[model samples]
Target: MDSRLALAAVVCAIVLCATPAALAQTVQVWTRGGRAYSLTCYTRFEVVPFYRPPNATSLVVAAASPATPPALQPTESGVSTIAAVLLVMSCIIVVVKSRSRAKFEMIIGKNSNRKENIEELLDNYGSLAPKRYKYSQLKDMTGSFSEKLGEGGYGTVYKGTLPDGNPVAVKFLHDLTSNGEEFVNEVISIRRTSHINVVTLVGFCLGASKRALIYEYMPNGSLDKFIYAENSKITLGWDKLYEIATGIARGLEYLHRGCNTRIIHFDIKPHNILLDHDFVPKIADFGLAKLCNPKESYLSMAGMRGTIGFIAPEVFSRRFGVVSTKSDVYSYGMMLLEMVGGRKNLKSSVENPSEMYFPDWIYRCLADLGSLHTFDMEYETEEIARKMAVIGLWCIQVSPNSRPTMSKVLDMFEKSADELEIPPKHCFYSAIQ
Candidate 1:
């Protein structure tokens, strides 16, 4: 009995030890008839003795569990995860780069199209097309822009010499916001003109980002310098001033009538008039010029144009009249008044508030011819001033129809002061008032 009890204790200990490896290993037991049975050990174990006949033998065999596969280390697992993240990030970067490249190409395409359109127009100009120069050539011709002659709203002018040794004024435009419209206007307008009174456009330069215009250099510079020269050495005698005014009128007449296409100089002012060594006036700065068919009497405008004091009444308000070449006549009239007065038509610094409006003072001066003596002019000079003033007043009449054509203005200039009639006092007031 004691021997049987000890064997049962040994069997229980073996079963408990093999429980962890039960899934991978097999246990075998031999019974009294020599039949082998396989048993898998579990958490709960039971040992049962076989009934042996006479001298029967009992045997138990257990095989070890196969070695379990080695588990993955922490470092190796981290490496695989990192590699997947990098691949995903690379794909995202490539997609973003492709999109950005497409956007940049679109902007470049638009600018190229605009340039092509302008070039195509120039090609159609045939023999009328002005000379074209490279941007680099401009720098060479202007001596690297060494001498700046003047500056204005559109650009700066530098004195340059052409290959033929003829002097030229090179204007380098700085305002790009106009989308090249001003540059195109100056070129096209001058190309159509071939009058001594009109400034000659020698050449032009248009590139991706640079634009410039080359013109015949006027030694005497702009008319504003001489007209506004207060107590300065630059002074034009009354006779010379009359000649300059008449030359400007002829130039305007050419623009309005002589050209195949009627051209209106929207911004006609003293500053835009250039003078040669002989002080002969030449109309310039066609940035605000408009081209229309000669048969069409009126022009359509998108917005008001010209300097404030010189803009015609009809240009700012349709109630005054339809916009037409008459608008240019009005500006010319204002410029004439400024020329005779030696000051702006509207003066804020006048001692007498009544004289603040120059046209009114000059109009009153015409009624009493002796009042003109205040200008310290001789009889002949007063005659010239009165003729110019009467003509100017007639041109500035509030109604467009009331203003004479450029042709009529030239006629008035040729007439004697006594022969001319002063415009009605009611017609001289500006619409803005």
Candidate 2:
């Protein structure tokens, strides 16, 4: 025991005296019959500094190797899962934003193209262009289409007012087809005429789907109102009726010969004739008017036009005659006869079924001039009525060639009532009979 204590004392002194580098190095100090001791025994009093055995350095290194911490395994897996989820979310956000941007750009491009096309159209119209109004202006003028005046096949007519405080009529055409033929026809036909008898086109709108036409307001509206309204408050005298008749004749004559081109109005009727505040007749609704060179006397049509009762026989069947301005004369004649009798020409409810047709009965009365009183004869207006009947007979001749020109019709109006003779019964009269 004493020997061991002395040895430990010496070893302790050596350990305290040795440099740090020396202590860290492995040393071989074997004593005969000595037991092995570990370097970790430095903290215990029972252990003395001991020499390393063979291969002891490797053993120490192997034993000191650290074990992996269990806490880190779950943390690593959680971090990996969170990273994958973030990557997927980022991808989704990018795809959604890209799609939205593409759609927005496409819409903007379409709007730009449409605006450019409308601007180009307006520019092409140039000096000859009628007043062009914006969609907003039309809405303001029409008060959001509040007061409707009438509606027809083409569109609805609304009452409007201008900045100058002038009341106007606005016709808003329907967008029935991609080809706007009716709108074009109405604008072109009326644009060429500056006559007082024609309805004046004040302005027009061509904004998007809202195509509209502006015209001077006719306070008295269409002539059909007075002629067809049995309960009309204002009863027109014979003089006034005759004046309206002559005005319509002059309007037709103007269309036939007055302009540089012969404008044949395919549809002519009381509904199409508008009257101003002073009762001056103005021809309206020129959607079917054809503009032809003066030398062209006939027009070939692909289809029939004009109202059923007013359309000339030739218009429906080629066997009657070639279509011409005379077709309008036939329509005018029918309208004139209706105005004279204050009833429809083809009425089926006549007291005498034998005289159901107006023209047939009128012809029989004219054949015997003494029977004029049978026509509810007012002595003062009998001659005026007879004169109109003679003119009507001349206009409705079966052959288009037999029909007089509109100018001749005007001259016939000035002739004395007795001098006007009834037109002879032709194929047209026979067909009706």
Candidate 3:
């Protein structure tokens, strides 16, 4: 009976109190983490002091009249509002800065230090080998083009022997003059921006509208031949393809962003990539390469010089104006897709018109789950398929800004499928003359 009476009194007191905290003479708080927090209730018509309490005013009811609230509110409220505004503004500022920086950076964390931008350094540094060489010297080294090694969009590549009898690959210009200078520029610039993954430039010779770049000989030859050739697919491993793709991405990123001035390898393709003894990718053929200023892109070409299917959509005279680093991104995307599909995308079967354009096939495959059922599961083709889809999707973003940089492409290849989304296939550009 006594307990009941006390409970009733407490309930009545709680209901009648004008200020919950004032109703109770004492207050306390407890927290789960051993930290303390408190909240107080006050009357609307109180004195309202201009001070703020750190953590005070817990609600309590004791049937007493309320105390007035303070004139000033909690600093947290003001601070929170101000902080929110500032945070949003800060975020906006960061995004704008990143976009602008990317124009200069041109890609992910790579430094923009192109050698051509500092050609003076190259000229001043000078070549360890002789700058000037007689045409006869080059002819003698190449064995008078008697040893034909390979051919590419740039020109014919021949085998040569240095003074030490070390084998070298000498790329001779087929057109001479204008063509040779571009090759020289590419060789010199690439040499200046050399890394271990890059094929080293030994030296050059200029004569009678004739120029040739000398490079270390690759026993295995270009990657395209090894990966796409008949009876060669099974010889490749998932790990090896991953390495090659990653290396290519890094090389492209270096050209696009790692230099002080951005370089666009506008002529990226399998033929342009030479392979070392271990099948490592060495980017070659810089004749069509474009040098972009910090935050600025190069002018478009007078006519298309890159391989037909690999050329960027923006490069066409009709679709857009002003080709940018994103041009390379588009090409990379296509290359990745090609690598994934094997030679099926490129192998022109006269009997089958459906196989003419492979990226279109990729889009069709992506649209239907049944299309991937034909994949050869006996090999590591699945892993190759997974990476190719991801890297290709990243490269082919319609907007240059939407695409991932070469650095990002390498990072993407390194990550697992669980961390990535199934990539979307790019739309085909209307065939441009």
Candidate 4:
């Protein structure tokens, strides 16, 4: 229990203990709404110390009345019945008053006196756990921003600590730059939304150009570090990889179709994808997120957004028109290809020019299911290759109109393996396999 709360409790005990004479004089009658009332009644006894366990307070409090008349003298049986009725009424009054006081204590329940809300302890939510710092107190929380974490186009991030001594990640934006708007948007988006797959925004910091966003520190760091690591054979195994893929897709689906406002993740890539303690994927960094009416097809930006390699071909085309949410679908498709290939989609490595070409190879793989077996044979490779090839190929289709909606892509995932149709080999690599 908090020392202050304990002290308050002690005060409550003293005040209650000190007012015994008044308490006895006017028995407080209470209603369910916590209001108190008083009623006058005949009482031969009063309740004693009720707060103490094993020996509850009960003291005899009697009321005086006129002496019984000789004409009203009762028989032995009648007197016994009268006594029984009076005793029962006294017990009821004592029980009600005791329950009322206990109830008052309950309404005043505090987190200092008890545990955090049950939902906070549970997952499937992204909460800013017990905010222990006010703006002035944040300097100690971030260790004066001494611990450098990472830097991005938007701003630099740092590591921080809580009064409870738990460590957290904080991203600090340079207040003098345009990055402040992006940081504010990210905080607003995350605070309003929560899902198992969404990155939990722990809190935020605002000071001039020194704005910062706090997140639940992920121990493993970003997904790009693992996938793009040099000579590392530590593959995110089939099950975990599948979960990561599905979780990211679900997060995107929620943004694209589940949210009250349609969100287009203009920048969806391995670098923006983070992993949690359980290895579940969390979609992060929405600096490039564009909000638009779902009823519309395009949201014009200053220019095309997102990483160069992942951007949709149509988006980069000189003849192609404005960018749309499907642009993200195209980038996600490329990301899926990278996951399937276990190599960069557009490898700048001079040794193999063909390595940069992914969708074409995937198209060739789909034309010949035999090639599917060679991809991550340790996995249910044939099935994965087939599904990835289908979904990926569909997402990267030249015309955005041809690509399946996120809901349809999810439906395609749910359908049995046998039910999925292998898309026709129509790309330039179609004749190879």
Q: How are the candidates ranked when ordered by lDDT, highest leading?
A: 1, 2, 3, 4
Please give the range of 10 consecutive residues that has the lowest summed lDDT in model 4.
29-38
TM-score of each: 0.68, 0.66, 0.62, 0.59
Per-residue CA lDDT of model 2 for 230-286, tens digit only, reads 732138778888899999999889988897677778778888899999889999866
* lDDT score, candidate 4, position 292: 17
Predicted structure with the largest lDDT when compared to the true one: 1
What would the per-residue lDDT of candidate 4 be over residues 24-119, giving only the tens digit for each residue?
Answer: 232333111111122433345223232446766666756434586755764443433333334444545544655576677786675223333332
* Candidate 4 Cα lDDT to native: 0.60
Question: Order of candidates by TM-score, top first?
Answer: 1, 2, 3, 4
Model 3: per-residue lDDT, tens digit, 1-433? 3443354455345435524343222121211111111122121111223446889785554643345345443333343333333333443444445446546656433322342433444466575432445678888988787898887555678999988898998876554434333444555565676765667778776665666678889887777776676655567765677678778888888878776557777767777777888888888765333321111122225655456667676676535535777888888788777677666445567366765776666666655652354555443556567657666866776657677877777778777655777555556653641
Per-candidate Cα lDDT values, in order, are 0.74, 0.71, 0.61, 0.60
Query: Which lDDT value does model 3 have at 173?
Result: 57
Residue range 325-407, candidate 1, lDDT tens digits: 99999999999998998888887888999788888888888776534887777788889988998989988898899999999
* Clash totals in order: 0, 0, 17, 10
